[model samples]
Target: MSTLSDYLNEHLPDGWQKPQLVEALSGTLDRATVYRYLAGSHPRSPAESVLEAFAKVLPGVTVVELRAAANLSAGAEEPWVPPVEANRLSHAQRRALESFIKATVGPIDDGDEPNHRQPSVDLQPAAPALTEQERAEVESYVQRLYASGRKDLADRVASSLVNNPSIEPATRPADA
Candidate 1:
């Protein structure tokens, strides 16, 4: 299983940030909605309208293909299969799909295991309750206090948890 970032970074061509793509689509969808799709956390199953929009912006992918990619299974509900045959691709669409496959699929190198594992998209490991950015902001505030020679103030700020009353004392590393 790969993270959503991995799939987006590796599979998508350049210039495919969710916001950029959504704006390009113009009122069709929101970027958060797209992230929900990619993160496989959409409330309802992938909608046709959203799928169609993605098909247009993304190269080498159809609505069906995007749906498949979006609903990659990994300890989540299986992807909802399209119900109506009407929504299915036409002959031309199939031909385009074939061409896309031809371009994207090539021989695996010797000892390479193509199709050895199913592909999946997952969120990055659950981040700390406080994110790196949040921690950086806190650290920056502490640094400002230190820079102003407010050592006591900086120590208080550094030791205090913004949300929690009980704070863990900063510990030195074994190497230090």
Candidate 2:
């Protein structure tokens, strides 16, 4: 069985029963569909929405982990840098980094945001709680960014989390 199937089969009974989970979804999915998913009768991976809803109420599991298990996620290939921090870097620093990247990665797309990016106040709100796994991933990636001398990107990704506790998504790793 797939890891997602095994996780569902094992954990479903621990916290939520079949009928109970169907109802808990608030009709997001039909009873028969849940049963089929539970029974491992479905061929495709569960929809992101289904897994997301399950992760919402499930205690320990995370949507990121679930998506990985379902073979939906490609796994982290490169560091997931933050864009909002571009504004914080001095123009010289931005140019230096861009030159380094351009030499290494050919050319950045024309649509890429330049040094002057949108402010944090302009960012859209994200409220769902970040799972432990997601938090760990963010911390690990941020550390990698710092170690690689990309403090600007690191600061951008993590500064929002530590600098402001009130920003909903910044408080957590962001909605899984």
Candidate 3:
């Protein structure tokens, strides 16, 4: 089984350092979290989130590698990138995806600055809320689904609640 530690050790070679890794790593990860993934001292196998973050910055690392490391790929074929045409991203969609990636993951140092031409975005603050009664009702629905041996249904409800764009993930109720 390939360990996350092995992946880190292999990738961080060629004079790579922790500070460089931290700066290069995308997502909301902190320095302490990076330290927790150190390969030199007390390395921890990265969680799915850590692996996903690594995928954004590290070349040749992707969802395939993530699954492989977890032994979930089940003898998968060699990794490959889909052709641009295969992706079917329209010109507008491509630009929008580039903009979103730059905003979230920053630049990839591919020898040039990003085009920086994108459609304007209307930033809006969403304050989604569910009344106590509504929360209780949802919770009851989930529990009933689980009790009836329909955990998949309960998980779907919980996933929808957690993934709703209107609600901030941090503000979700504990039961959700």
Candidate 4:
């Protein structure tokens, strides 16, 4: 997926400053508006309407499509430019997006081998290890998730650990 920065830099017309663009959208919108808009806050109501003005300023297409595309692509390490919208996605396009995000942000070494996996995010060096109290708090949170039958969130947590670079992975040899 094109980084949000790329979209802002390339799509916004030349000679118009980002602040100017923000001003055009809403006179009261501040610097943070430009920052968050480019940083990829998904559209909410009036902001959604403003995207149309953006398309006009940029020219040619409907803003809803642009916003939807950006919404799906936000925060991804790669550019996932779908030539068509969700409704128009072919089986192939669907598979590609799923594969892309799963590979980029989902679990590591999930059996698609031969391509070395580098973490999309480089986390800061670890701080001191978790305190016993911190561990207890985390354990309680996990237990609460399980007790509430939020298995999907539990699965996401497990996947995050599997992909995390902070913890060295435990390895086991294959057995006959």
Candidate 5:
């Protein structure tokens, strides 16, 4: 169970240091960022762009392998599926589930009473719709992927945007 850092150190090119690797990445990432990732101290998962850049500079490394090394699932290509239990939930059942979850986890704001006030469970709000400009930005990024000869990736991105209607693009204002 070697960690990603171990793999990177073992396969580093002769005479290459962290600074050299940063330079090889064309400064898209900094030495400290690279070190943090290698040290597994990053607060969040490394962005796909960062992983792709590392794959480009590191010999015999692929983005898939890098993702796996970071403990990410390799089956991102699989179709999305809702849980069977989720698909069968009625409105009452859903409410019951939400109540159960809230009861188990307690409330987000417990500082007010500490033990006196009952835990409050609020329903999460719907996600905001993407503005026209944001839609254009995503389209532009997908186009760039196509231009870079990564049509498969471009298609996947496009498909994800289309399939997830909660993030549908908003209609522009008439005056604007």
Candidate 6:
């Protein structure tokens, strides 16, 4: 596999040097940084913005190719598999999602008097309780979370469902 340094040396256009390249990169990176990149000794992965700049400056060399040369990806084509039924969010996730929605969408009010708003006159109906199948799906998601090394999140999710009086506990799979 070609390293980033090798790619740079091979592809840099004629008459271009480290200083010129640095200047072309809009001074975000210094000449020494360019040297380190050419030396293959930069401490961190090149930022995407830097890669984009390089793509603009270097003719015939693309960011994707540069990323591949940097060992960022295998550059293989793969079939996409839709995710296992979308994972059900825990109560905490639900709260976070609701907060995010509210932050982005702001409060919704039907054109009624703001000061006279009534709690009984909600425009949208309340969400229905989860069905048994949905509960099973949530349990599956929790199990997957634990398996994927997110035990803390999984524990919180399970605990939330267990502690909630409104939600019935999910039935566990026999194999679990």
lDDT of each: 0.46, 0.53, 0.47, 0.44, 0.53, 0.54
Q: What does candidate 6's lDDT look like per residue over 106-129, in tens digits?
A: 223222322122222122312223
**Model 3: colliding residue pairs:** none
lDDT of 4 by residue, 28-50 (tens): 44567566766555233224445
Candidate 6 stretches with Cα past 4 Å from truth are 74-176
- For residues 1-176, could you state the per-residue lDDT of candidate 2 as single tens digits? 44556666666646567778778766677787677767666544466678777777667767665555554432232345758966786555555454433233221122322212211112222223334444444556566567767677776766534422443322222322
In model 1, where do residues sit more than 4 Å from their true spots?
Answer: 1-10, 70-176
TM-score for all models, in order of appearance: 0.33, 0.40, 0.34, 0.31, 0.41, 0.42
RMSD of 4: 14.2
Measured over all alpha carbons after superposition, the RMSD of each candidate to the real structure, in angstroms, is 21.5, 18.1, 17.5, 14.2, 18.1, 19.5
* Alpha-carbon RMSD, candidate 3: 17.5
- Per-residue lDDT tens digits of candidate 3, residues 2-85? 244455556663677778888876346777776665542322223556656766766765644543443232122343465766
Tens digits of per-residue lDDT, candidate 5, 1-176, equal 22456556665788998778878876687888778766656533356778777878999877666555544333332334657857665565455434433333332222332222211223221222334445555556555556667677666655534523656532322332
After TM-score superposition, the amount by which residue 140's alpha carbon in candidate 2 deviates from its true location, in angstroms, is: 34
Between candidates 3 and 4, the lDDT winner: 3
TM-score, cand. 1: 0.33
For TM-score, candidate 5 versus 6, the one ahead is: 6
On lDDT, the leading prediction is: 6
- The global Cα lDDT (0 to 1) of model 1 is 0.46
Q: Candidate 4 has which clashing residue pairs, if any?
A: 1-78, 1-79, 1-80, 2-79
Q: After superposition, how far is residue 158 of candidate 6 from its true place, in Å?
A: 18
Error of 4 at 155 (Å): 34
* Residue 131, model 5: Cα distance from true site in angstroms: 23
Task: Name the candidate, 2 or 3, with the larger lDDT value.
Answer: 2
